[model samples]
Target: MTVAPRIAIDAMGGDDGLPVMIEGAARALGEDPALRFLLVGDEAALAAALSARPALAAATEIRAAADVIAGSDKPSQAIRRARTSSMGLAIDAVKGGAADAAVSGGNTGALMAMAKLALRTMSGIDRPALAALLPTLGDNDLVMLDLGANTECDANNLVEFAVMGAAYARAVMGLAAPRVRLLNIGVEELKGTDEVRDAAALLRGATDLPLRFDGFIEADRLGRGEADVIVSDGFTGNIALKSVEGTARFITDLLRRAFTSSLRSKAGFVLSRPAFHMLKTHLDPNNHNGAVFLGLNGVVVKSHGGADAGGVANAIGVAAKLVRADIARRIADDLAHFRAGPRTAVAAK
Candidate 1:
């Protein structure tokens, strides 16, 4: 018999609050009947919301939480309310082994801070990184890491991100060995800062790693799917991610305007409706909604704050999938091998 994966949800964390979270959980439960939830939020509001979601209600158990960490709250402010806040309690459920993983559509900084404090780093991992899947030209999505979790990262950090990111690709992308690359201004080893070059040199020689360490990738080629995993410091990764999102939106809007500009264009759009619908589905943010904090002892998935029910369901799905796949163990094993194999080689040479 397969054991059901349990997820702890920060019900009041996102812009849509409990209603969307509940609806999302309901949708997820409908798809995965064996799934269960530990919903952390205000008891009265959650109960009221869950009444309409009988399937979700049956699979959920509300854990009362009085406070919510607001979107504007700083990490320092959020840590103080860790015990009382909905997001914090949801994380706690994972720490306490009450749930397999925690999913939240909340303040990213706060969630990272609280999760780090609560779960700490797995042995040998210095810092946790936020990783997510991005649609690429390939049949499979590519994994990118340090997505605003650590604004600054050193060479060692970048190498660690590669190991962790590759493990993530293995778990989610179903790749046996993902091709990893360092995101840089240029592909040449001579380009980029000391940190990136150093990280690249290390990855290039780390024969023990299961992943293929491609030298570098420029931001312009990210969607080409040339690499399976792209590693970057949070500052660079966040900017690149936003740039891609903006470009997608711009193209979508341009198509909309073009289709409405003339009867001829409208007729063309009608003829190509199926292709356009496929494009829309492929580019939709909801399909890739979860961003995971890797290197933590427990799994923590971040949902986009403004995501709708479909997006929220996708995030929950990601969390549940990671739990079932034992992603934490995979990362730990890979990190252990990485640390033991090339501890002195990267920096020494």
Candidate 2:
């Protein structure tokens, strides 16, 4: 963590293909020139592509991995091919200490399976949660999980998530004591299911923990700046994430239509161009492109397959930041404290 991270890039895993992935690495280097990469994919193709990117080529080493995990491949099937796949080797680089972290735009299920198998969950974590940062109107971005990792979770899982999430916020966002909330039907204590209510009770009693646990938060208030960490089962979290994304797209599209409806509207758009540009930047998925698999022994970031070069660079940046901060050790300490009994655990300053 004291020096620049050496990252392992799954170069053949994205939809836009190798070009965007390579360009993303180059872009990341342009921002932080201390980065180095272990590019895993076809040897000839990688060599040919990097020939055009002199700086990236100079900072990278190619590791030929001939196989690729298809987007349509199931995790069960893909797990068997881990030894030969590009995504697999990238993760392997992290497990083997050849790299500080791994970044891939490959199949999520496959990546999760391979990472869990290779890196294993941390000592106190039962399962690894998929967590990502969402742009909020608050002082800093919000961290939300499980985002489709655990379809169903008990009260224990929920509490564990809150601990992991709060640790993530503190380590990566530099929050001393983040406000944690359960994703529920309403802010009322009794409004959600039994599991949510039980989790809330546990969190409220956990004063010795590092976070400030509120009662509950409704999905509509996700971006309202009310909470710092949001926890939920994967099913609900995934739906809420998609709903937010869809709403952003709908609003942007609606504005596009309205702006072109008449000459006056077009002129109004021209006058309001700067505001619209800011709006676009806020709504763009590329700006929030990295989703980390929390609780693993090593850091592995999941990039959206449809991400452009900018998006991939942002994902790589997320991975690099996590590496530089030693997020894994931070989460492990919190998890260990949680596993030991809250009454015995001391609040983090």
Candidate 3:
């Protein structure tokens, strides 16, 4: 019989700490009887949470550790000082073959640092990028890469990101021959800085890739279903992602206030409850909490710091799917293919 893949969760990492993480782990296990979790954190809190659910208690194995990395701690300093922190322990679990993958909602910088230091990067990958799936106007979700991970990227790095993002989209979104786009100031090839223009030229000449190069994409056209995978520098990608999140929250709050303003509106809200719920689910960050750090040797998922139990559960589900798909291995294979092809001649400025 095939053994079920084990997931290492940082129970003491997120804002809500062990309680919410444990709840999320329990929920995930409840969904799949074969799923096993390795919870890394304070022994007492983890035991208490698991003990509440007898079945989950049996499914989970706890790794007792003392330290907890705070969000405010410096990534380098925290990584060195807190060797036994939940996040560090989770990475160790994956490294030591105790788990197939790991999930964390703690310090982003610290998590990235630990992952790089512990798991390292796949061949030909200059840096591992944080890639997320965003809801788009199209039928399929758009995979955006380098989301707050690498602030400054070069032409080759962007090309590498494009390849990785395309592979992820094809595997996760089930899109054959996924359309790839480079996020830029304008859709034209001549627009943006020398870096983007150079990257666009390189992508255009990458005829060996399975992805369809769709040229440049503007930020405004991101939600309009322009491309299946959007690649950009971390600075731009993070700003765009946060802006969309803030806008989504503002719109939801406004709708809530409007719906509760009067009896008639409240009655309408009751009648439209199903539709409202669907819309909320479509826009909810919790439903899409998992952001994979692509180009790594092993699957490492980073959830939102303020994620709830549902979000954490969804992140775990994402990690499971990634592990089943062998996403890292696939990415490495694709990168190797791209590198083996004739090097594209750099376009003249």
Candidate 4:
């Protein structure tokens, strides 16, 4: 009999405390009945929270964590406290074979440091990437990587990200052959840094991989919904991700202000309420709450720190999908094939 995936959660990681964490776990359990949780935090607090929801409490196994990692804690400092902290314990559960995956809504830097130090990168992976799906105008969401993990990356790293991102796309997005692209200054062949250009060249030559390389793509076209997987160094990727998020918020805020500006505007808003609701849903960060650290030896999903129960549940959903799909194995297999070297088949000709 196949066993259900058990997830280890950092019960004290996020901006919100115990109640939100427990409620989120309950919500996720409600969605996926087969999922079991290993909640790591203050045992007494967890027990009290779980008492009201006996169903979640029964499905959960609470582990004691004496400390919580602060949002301002540096990665180096967080690493030192890994043994007793809630985030640390949750990751430890995954490492020790108690859980299939770990989820935390904590300091991104600290989480990366702890997860890397604990789980280590998969074989042939130099650095693990933080990948998240972004809203797009097309039928499917776009997968962008290295959101804030490795500030600088080489050609080989970008190539590796493409392979891992493609596997991730298949696992989460259900895309059999995801179209991959590098974030660049221009779509032209001569654009971007040496690393970006070289990675593009390498990807163009590797048609054997289970992905379709679509060459370079300008950052401006990221949300047009054409590309499936986008690769970039963490420095550039983080900036782009923030810019996109800021733009979304600006638009949303502007819309709200305009709608409430006057009686006429309010009437107009009511007339187009359904369309506005769709737009609001599309721009909701909670809808895209999970960011996975790809290329890790095991699965570790990072939830937005300010996420609500619904957002936390969505993040858990991302982790569950990865565990069920055996995404780590798929990435390992792809890396093995890719490391064997690409054929001399450059589509750029």
Q: What are the C-alpha RMSDs, in order, of all predicted structures?
A: 1.7, 2.7, 2.1, 2.2
lDDT for model 2, please. 0.90
Per-model lDDT: 0.91, 0.90, 0.87, 0.91
Q: Candidate 1 — which residues are off by over 4 angstroms?
A: none
Stretches of candidate 4 off by over 4 Å are 1-3, 344-349
TM-score, each model?
0.95, 0.95, 0.94, 0.96
How far off is model 1, as Cα RMSD? Answer: 1.7
> What lDDT does candidate 4 reach at residue 167?
97
Q: Which digits, one per residue and each the tens of the lDDT, describe model 1 over residues 101-151?
A: 999999999999999999999888888999999999988898999988888
Clashes of 2: 0
Better of 1 and 3 by lDDT: 1
By TM-score, the better pick of 2 and 4 is 4
Q: TM-score of model 3 relative to the true fold?
A: 0.94
Clashes of each: 0, 0, 0, 0
**Per-residue lDDT tens digits of candidate 2, residues 138-255?**
8888999999999999887888889889988887788999999999998877798988998888788777678999879999899988899999988899999999999888988898
Q: Candidate 3: minimum summed lDDT over ten consecutive residues — where?
A: 340-349
Candidate closest to the true structure, highest TM-score: 4
Clashing pairs in 1: none
